[model samples]
Target: MTAADLALLDEEVTHCRACPRLVEWRERVAREKRAAFRDQTYWGRPVPGFGPADARILILGLAPAAHGANRTGRMFTGDRSGEVLYAALYRAGLATRPVSVSADDDLRLIGTRITAPVKCAPPANKPEPAERDNCAHWLRRELRDLAELKVVVTLGAFAWAAWWMALEPVYGVRPPTPRPRFGHGVVHQMPGLPAVLGSYHVSQQNTFTGRLTPAMLDDVFRQARSLAGEESRG
Candidate 1:
C-alpha cells in the first residue's frame, strides 16, 4: 500500500501546474536549451523524490537547478551541485555511484532519498513564498508516504523551514514555539518526529569557496547515518 501511494504521488508531482511563475520558468528553460546540452532533451517539469521507498534518511534541498534537474527529470542530476552531493553519498556508502549525469545513469541512493521543498525550477533559483506554499502539498504527501523516514538532512535553510512546516500539516508534529534557525551540523530532535539536521548547500558558492569541504559534507552524512541508526559502509 505504501509503495503504491508513493508511486502515485510521484506521478502526480510531474503534472503539477499549480504555480504560474514556476510553470513559466521551468518550461522556458526547457524550451531554450543551453549550448552544452543543446543536443539533449529537457524534462522541464516538477521533479519528484526518488530512492528506496522505505528510506530512513531524507536529503532535502531547496529546489531543482534550472539546468540540472530541469534538464534531467531527476533530482540532483546533470549539475555540479549534484556532483558534490552524489560523490559524498557514494563515499558514505549511501549511493551506488559517485556521479549523476542524467536520470538514466547507473546511480542509486541506497538508504537515502532526495527531495525539495519546491518541485519546479524557479526563476533565478528562487521560489516565491506563495509558490513554495502552493507546492507544499507534494512534500506533505511525500513525507506521509515515506513510512520509514527517520532523519532529514536539510541542505539549506529553505529545506529546513519546509520540513518544519510539514511536521504539523503532514505528521501532526507541532515543533516547539519559535521554530529553530538553520545551522550546519546542528541537529534538532523533537518528540514524535524524525530528527532533522542542517547542512550548508553543496552549491559552487559553498564547495569551491571552501565554505563546505568534502570532509565537512561527509561528516554531515556520517551524522545522518548515526542518527538513523544505520551502519556505515563508507
Candidate 2:
C-alpha cells in the first residue's frame, strides 16, 4: 500500500457519517462539554488513525473515549488511559514522551502506528455489533495500507477480535477455527499476517485494579518491538 492511499483513506474517514448512532452520540458529547474541559472546543467527528505509513507495528484500541479522543481529535489523547499507555510506550522505547495531551503534542512513535476499530466515541463506551461491522471497512482498508506491518498489539478483547477479523479480508485467508482468545501477554501467530499480541486495555478499570501494570505493558511492547525488528531485517 502507498502513502497516498493511506492519506486518501484518512481524509475519507474523517467525513464518514455512516453510523447514525455514533454520529448522534459523538455530537451530543461535544455539545455538552465536560466540567474539566469546559473551555476547550471538542472535535465531534470521526478520529483518523495516525502514524507513519510504513510502520511495522500496529496498536489497536477499542474506541475513542467520550471526553478523551472525542475531545482532542486524536486517539488515546487527553485522558487517563493515555497517561498510562504512553508512559509504558516511552519506557519500552516506542514513544518519545511519557504523556499524550493533545493532537499537536509532538509525541512520536518508533516503528509503530495506532488506530481504533470504532472511529467515533460511543455512548457509554460501548459500540453495538452493527457499528463494529460497519466500522470494520475502514479498519480493513487500513490494514491493507500498512504494507510493512508485522506485529499487532490489541488493547482488549474487542480490539483482538477486530484485528483478527480484519486479517481475513485484508490478507485473503480464512481464519482458523475456535478463534484465539484474548488475555494479557497472549500471542497469536498467523501466516501471511502480523502476529497478534493481546493485552488488557490501558483503561482505568484495568490499570486501577492492577490487572494491567507497567511491567505487564512493557513486556508486551518489548516483544512487539523485537518481532518488528526481526521483520525489518528479513
Candidate 3:
C-alpha cells in the first residue's frame, strides 16, 4: 500500500461514526480497559483496511474483535483469530510475517490485504443489517481501488454473502436461484473477479478445537494462490 492510501484509510477510520451503537460500545471498552492498551491509541471508532493496497487477493472478515482490533487499531491484531489467520497466510507465502500485533509491527502482504464487512466492534460482535449495508459502500470502494484484485477470500458466511451481493452487480450475473451455501474451502468464480474462495472464520472455536487446522487452512490458501496465478510456497 502507498503511504497516501494508508493515510487516507487511517483518517477515515479515526473519524468513522457510521453506527452510534458501535461507537458507544467501543468507547466503553476503551474507558474500562485504559491501562491495558495505554500506549496503543484505541481505534475504538472503526477499523480500516490493512496490508498492501495493491494486493491482488482481498481477505474479507466479519468484523473487528472487541478486545482485539478494537483495542489495537489494526484489523485482526491482538487477537487469537488473527494469530491463526496470519499463520496460515504466512505459510501460504501471502504474508511476510507470521503474526499481526500492531500496525507498527513489521509485517507485509505481498499479494493480499485484509478487511472487514463491519469496521467497528459491534455489541456482542453482531452487526445488524442496516449497519452492514451502511458499511458496504466502503467495501465496494476498496474493491474498486484494487486494480490488480483477482480473488477475494471470505472468512465466514456473512462475509461471503456481503461480497457476493456487492460484486454481483459489477459482474452482471443473474442472481443464483437459491444462493450458494458457504462451506469451508469452497471456491466460486464470478464474471468480474475470477475467484471468490469461502472458508470458516478463524474464530477461537474453530482453531482451538481443531475444526480448522493449519494444514487445512494452508490448503485453502494454496488453492487461492493457484487461482490468482501466484506461486504457493506451502
Candidate 4:
C-alpha cells in the first residue's frame, strides 16, 4: 500500500466514533480540561498511528492517554510515557529526537512507527474489550499497509495480545498454542510474522517505581533494532 493509502486510513481513524463509551470518555476529558492544560485545545478525537508507511519497526502501544494523545492528537505525545518511549527510540537510532511533546514538533521516526490497537483514550487508561474490537480493523489495516515491517515491540501485555489479535486475520495464522507469554525483554518469533518483543509500558507507574528504567527500555529497543536487522547508531 502507498503512503497516501495509510494517510487516508489515518483520516478515517480520526473521525471514528464507533464505541460510544470511548467517544463519551474522550470527549468528556477534552471538555473537562486537565488543570495543567486548561489553556490548550484538546484533540478529543481518535488518535492515529505515527511514522512512515514502510517502517521496519512497529511499536505497539495499548491506547492513547486521556490527557496526553487526547490533548495533542498524536499517539504517545505530550505525556511522560511518550517522554520515556521517544527517548529510548532516539537512543536506539529510531527517532530524530529524544522527546515527543506535540504532533507539530520536528520529531520524526526513522524506519519506525508507533500506534495502538485502541485509537481513542479510554477512562482510566483502560479500554473495554468491545472497544478494542471496534478499533481492531484500523490496526489490521496498519499491519497490512506496513509492508516492510520486520519487528513489533509491544509495550505491555495489552499490546502484545492486541498484536496477536490483529495479526491473525492479516496473516491468516493463529497465535501459537499456549501463546508466548508477555514479559519485559521477551521475544517471540514465528515464520511469516514479524518478531514480537515485549517491554514494560512506559508509564510513570513503572518508571517511578523502579520497575522500568532508561537502561531497560533502551535494551528492549536495542534488541528490537537487532531483530529488525537495523545497524546500531547509539
Reference-based TM-score of each model? 0.97, 0.96, 0.91, 0.97
Scored by CA lDDT, what does every candidate get? Answer: 0.92, 0.90, 0.82, 0.93
User: Lowest-lDDT window of 10 residues in candidate 3?
Assistant: 168-177
Collision count for each candidate, in order: 0, 0, 1, 0
Q: For candidate 3, report its TM-score.
A: 0.91
Summarize candidate 1's per-residue lDDT along 156-223 as a digit string, tens digits. Answer: 89899998989899877687789998999999998768999999999889999999999999999999
For residues 1-234, write the lDDT of model 3, one tens digit per residue.
365765576567668788888889988887776566666667676888886767778899999998899888888988899999998999888888999998788888878889998888988879989989888877876776677787888998999998878865555566565777899988887566658899888999888998888888898888888888786433
Clashing pairs in 4: none
Clashing pairs in 2: none
Q: What is the model-wide C-alpha lDDT for candidate 2?
A: 0.90
Query: What overall lDDT, based on C-alpha atoms, would model 3 receive against the true structure?
Result: 0.82
Model number with the top lDDT:
4
lDDT by residue (1-234, candidate 4, tens digit) is 999999999999999989999999999999999999999999999999999998999999999999999999998999999998999999888899999999999999999999999999999899998999989999999999999999999999999999988767999998988888999999999997899999999999999998999999989988988889886543
RMSD of 3: 2.4
Model 2 over residues 163-189: C-alpha lDDT tens digits?
Answer: 878876888887778887888889988
- Could you tell me how far off, in angstroms, the CA of residue 229 lies in candidate 2 after the best superposition? 1.6
C-alpha root-mean-square deviation, each candidate: 1.2, 1.7, 2.4, 1.2
